[model samples]
Target chain A: MNITSDMIYGYTDGMILCCLSEQDSYGYAINNFILEKSGFKYELKEATLYTTFRRLEKQGHVTSYWGNESSGPRRRYYSITQEGRAYLKQRIREWKEIRQLMDAFFIDKKEEETET
Target chain B: MNMEEKIILYINRAFAGSPAAEKTEEAKEALCADLLEKYRGLIEKGHSPEAAYQATISGIGDIFELVDSVTGENREKALPSSSKILPAAESFQKWGPAAVCGIFFLLWLIRFYLAPGLLFASGLPTFLLGAVLGALGMRAFLHRNRLSFAPLLPKEQRPYQLVWGGCGLLFLAALFSRRLNPALWLIPAGAVALHQVISAWIAFSASRKEEDFHE
Candidate 1:
């Protein structure tokens, strides 16, 4: 049986919050960040990305505004709010705990026991 | 059409049945811009225009569902009351006045049949009177419901209250002045029109101010 871990495929909100934590970005730019961060293995559908944006804004975790670019079409940029940062921090802590739990459950426990 | 235009056309077609509103337009514009950017990026990566267009279009999942979810969220937020009460309230709002108008018409019909001379001697068309009264009642009902139901933002509360208050004063003045000249009834009508214009203006300016702040 072929087993693979694809935990990063979901967590669209957390990925977006992480992206915005560094700097504010627009739809395409944030998706680009996700694309690159995921080693080009995952890309969000436009619908999913924008819906997450709306959801995050509604949750007061992010705020959006129009970009005042002089040379191109106006883009709506999102920035993480203070609440978003705190939410992201909590998510990261949860992710670390989950990661540890998964490694403990899925790794070669027999080999570790023999080694000890 | 150019690639940008093609993307715009696709977006327009996707959102065709959605209600035309400011937020919908914003969503459409954002989608178009993002799709075009992605398409250009694909082209830059040596993908042919057709392939890029196909890929770009494919990346947008079920746009109708997205729009529905977004608008549905707004609908939910705009009405915090129970969902069961909405359809009942809406039907009443739509048909209650209409039913009253019908009843008034029926009464007029009976009076006409029984006392045709007296009906004509009243010097006013009873049907028109009933219709006007019914319409006024419906308007007032709708106005009241709209104000009550629409959870206004803190920024808009003041202007909304002021406009409604001013309109009420104008309405009362018009009613009192009707004793002076019957034509003064037009004052209330003018007040209604003025109220709408002022409300629309306030809404427009508020949106403009938000845009400026964002920019």
Candidate 2:
């Protein structure tokens, strides 16, 4: 609750990309998946979420199709493209490298604090 | 009109002039349902309906920014401003009716007087300039991590381009004509030239909106 909204959204593009990597899913389903996975820490604004879906689809990282929903509105489902998968893999590799570097960088500070 | 209809209309112009108009409508309805829910939530929280609706519309803040980021607009913008553009790309993107007027400004005396080395140093300047542009473009694209930038495209760019292009054309014609003063033509031509940029921008934003509402 004390965290900035930026932190929540910082991970959002990746999270959604990762979810789509599994299979094609509609707007509501993707939102639900995020909510469940994060245990409510990552509930996205409805406007924010769909806007991103539109953006991602436009970028060629993902493709969307209309779903035959019988309820409120027909869902627009999205799935990742091959290009998107490559991009995601690159991001994952980069994230891992960054994380490893951070861990190494922090160890010296951690040891200093412990000794002090 | 209800919240649903209003938001759909709001996004309608996104697909302006395209054959994909109907699909754009459907997508707007589907995508803007999120806005409808927010409208309802606002009404539930005691905000007047109009106020809530306006807030939601304004908050979306140029949906195309998100569109551009995902679509690799940055990639196109960053396409290495090389001094020597390759023969392969064949410069499909250059030139317009307004470009005819830009040729006049090639008034090389200005470039020659300012930096004669620019002719010879093309590659280095291009590389350095590219690095700077790439940085700014990335920052602009990323929002760097902000929710919104104050101004949006189309609204900011389209009309501006049309006006500038129109004036540029008009002045270029006037320059060719023997009647009007070439000097007077420059100011209007310059303004129109400025507007031409806005027009191109409008086209880009419109295309972006169309991409989101794909058939």
Candidate 3:
């Protein structure tokens, strides 16, 4: 609830891709990973999740294949692409840079507090 | 359709009837297997079947938004060099082969009638064969691994099946005209057009749906 929606949407695809890079996964598995990792703090709607899958696939960040299940229809399993790995690396750098920038600005408040 | 069923329907709509045999089935099987497993787990955890399915679906997300963002959706684009300027290049992208074949077909009709047996050794059916083979070859080209424009084309190319397929049937009818009367050929032609037009309309309508991916 405290997190800005923008921040969540922006990073979701990258997070999903990074998760998929570890191994191929389907939509639900990916969602669960996000939930478990965030300690149930962050969850994406199914619509948002598939859109990220589509976006990543479109961007050459991931590829999906179908596998037969014991019951019901086949599942579409997605995996990270080489380009996706490179993209995740870039996003990681950008996220770190943003974190450091925010930390610097927020900590600067302490310096000004003493001066005042 | 129920939530789970709806998901299956969409996946089939996307990957079924692809140019290659294995490609569509492969896509369908993978999506179905994982989605169903997830659905099963939710049901086991004390959720109503429908609610569980809904929750699972709500978590998966919108495909068009994904496709649009994936390929970077653009404003209406016209097929190049056409003063007639048919709207919807994205739409045309699907039927590209048919439209191309249509032009060639019309040309061939003229040639076959005006210059009957011009390529006397191979005959008209040979040209038709060439068209079918050409379409097949192009399908092979389009679906080839390390596909030239993989990311852009995969999601976008699916809608074209009806178009290419229509042209193919038309070409086949024309090829086998001697075996079957010219009148019988129109059945397939009408069927082809009906299918492509309807499919094109559906795909185009879906294209207009809200991408719904915030930020």
Q: Top TM-score: which candidate number?
A: 1
lDDT score, candidate 2:
0.62
Per-residue lDDT tens digits for candidate 1, residues A1-116, read 22122445457899999999999999999999988987877788898888889889989999999888676567888999999999999999999999899888768786788889
State the lDDT at A60 in candidate 1. Answer: 100
Candidate lDDT scores, in order, read 0.75, 0.62, 0.65
Mind giving the per-residue lDDT tens digits that candidate 2 earns over B64-135?
A: 653333334434543444324645434323322223334433434345346656654533344344345444
User: Model 1: which docking level applies?
Assistant: acceptable
* Interface DockQ per candidate: 0.37, 0.14, 0.35
Q: Fraction of the real A/B interface contacts present in each candidate?
A: 0.55, 0.16, 0.77
- Tens digit of lDDT per residue, candidate 3, span A31-105? 789888888888766557766676687678898766665666666888888999999999999999998999899
For model 3, the DockQ equals: 0.35
Q: lDDT score, residue A68, model 3?
A: 62
lDDT of 3 by residue, B106-200 (tens): 66666666877675445656666556655665564454322344434566555565556666666656665675555665666676677778687
Checking candidate 2 for backbone clashes, the offending pairs are A59-B70, A59-B71, B160-B195, B161-B195, B161-B198, B161-B199, B164-B192, B164-B195, B165-B196
Every model's TM-score: 0.59, 0.43, 0.46
